[model samples]
Target: MKKSLIALAVIAVSGTAFAQSSVTIYGKADIGVARSIGSDVNELKQAAGSRVGFRGTEDLGGGLKANFTYEHRFLPDTGAVANTSSFFTGRSIVGLEGGFGRIDMGRDYSAAFWTALAGDVFGYDGVAANGGVAGAGYQTVRFDNVISYKSPTMGGLTLEASSALKEAGAKNGSAIRVSYASGPIAASIATEKGLAGQKYNGFGASYNLGVASVRALISKGESATGVESDGMLLGLVVPMGALQLKASYATLEVAGKDTVQQMGLGARYALSKRTDVYTSYANNSKSTAAKKNGIEFGVQHNF
Candidate 1:
């Protein structure tokens, strides 16, 4: 759908609205309880990482714009913020966006995050592998003070890159991603390197088949955790009227020795344009140990 802008009519006499750009406030809050089942262990915990925040945008005119955002997380039920945690504060930053694309400098998501996000059916409901090859059993999230650039789409392809400053005397790792989408087909390639001697590379592709879409990803990674691993994921998301159904399977292999596999299925009901309620379940090799699998039923509102 083409975006539409609505201008409010105001007096020109000492007009404060246009003379200076305006600030907007918006945020999201959600809470839920969760339980996971391992082979021999089972645990329950109050929902965590619920959040809220403020964001603003200003028009400099002439197709130029400036903006800032500050997002934070809190325990809605207990009303507590993540302890002394403001690093990225749940995605805080300042940046600009225009016709040529966008650039932002601050803690950010790497281009490799695509695989991670592919499994975020409920804003990430704690699935093993989190859809990346971060040496298996782990999902690499965001980086700090990242300068990210996104290029305008060209010939059905778009590209993104991010770089973060590693402390001192360190080679800050970087991530690059490229994708092409035309009609019912899309594909992407991504890779990342961590300053702590960790490295990851992967590729993903998707195709629309009638009311459903199919996707797959594969990656290999190394980390100082004495772990070297490889992994892959296969997923399908189908849309049915007001609801969307998702199912996925993933595997993690350790040094060509042991392999752990997982599968998940879920459904999302769109309550409105920017609001949704979802639930999902995951099972892994450890199921025999804690076998609760995992389930989350929650709502998310975005503006």
Candidate 2:
């Protein structure tokens, strides 16, 4: 009886500690059908990057808090893991937040990604990604074994920096981003350095005039082997009731080659606060090849 009483007391204490923390489960499911010029059959696509995650925060007192997040990506079509070898390929992070700012360590997006995605009309979605169509590609989406820091916003300015530790012979990566958002204007400048001296720099800005918004981004990339590429993107978004219309044009120029151009148009309709349907079309034109066009339609749900 004495031992049992002690066990119950311990359980109660543990329960109380758990109650001090808040945890939430969230996920997104998105799938679509896409048709391209060279495909014999239309392919199903993961339009919004399906993911499930848990995030929690614990008030540790003294104006400081502990936070953690774990997320995994999966394919809704086949119910298969996006990265079979790594369970939490999407993100796994833990850190602290206080008056100074926030710092996290684990797998997280590079600073450059935040900047690029901010200016992207189509985001980094597969097939229609602005990175592939215009920017320096999605080469710096996420980094493992990383430490990132964010400064508190002051005077409409915020700063972020991150570094990835070298693991498995992969080169160390580092990135920085500076952003400002005030009233109807927002802008960001970001840079990244990857293994083998690959470097990327980008600047983006957007302005909203109530009725519509315009966004643009320019990026330069240099390969370790001395080749260079420059990219530019321009996009517009218009909102009408529950519907949004978007159009974008992008160009990529490589040394001694004709510029590659891509154009995209899309529309999204909101069925509710948590569900939406979208349709989009993209055309990629290269100087040395026939133009390839793709069309997509899909629905997404968040919970």
- Candidate No. with top TM-score: 2
Give the number of the best model, judged by lDDT.
2
Residue 64 lDDT (model 1): 73
Listed in order, each prediction's TM-score against the native is 0.81, 0.90
Candidate 1: count of backbone clashes, pairs at least 3 residues apart or interchain:
10
- RMSD in Å for model 1: 6.1
The regions of model 2 sitting more than 4 angstroms off are: 1-20, 37-40, 287-291
Stretches of model 1 off by over 4 angstroms after superposition: 1-10, 13-22, 39-49, 119-123, 126-129, 132-139, 168-171, 224-227, 286-288, 301-303
Q: Candidate 1 residues 203-249, lDDT tens each?
A: 77778898898877777777757577887777788999999988887
Error at 293, model 1, angstroms = 1.9
- Collision count for each candidate, in order: 10, 0
lDDT of 1: 0.68
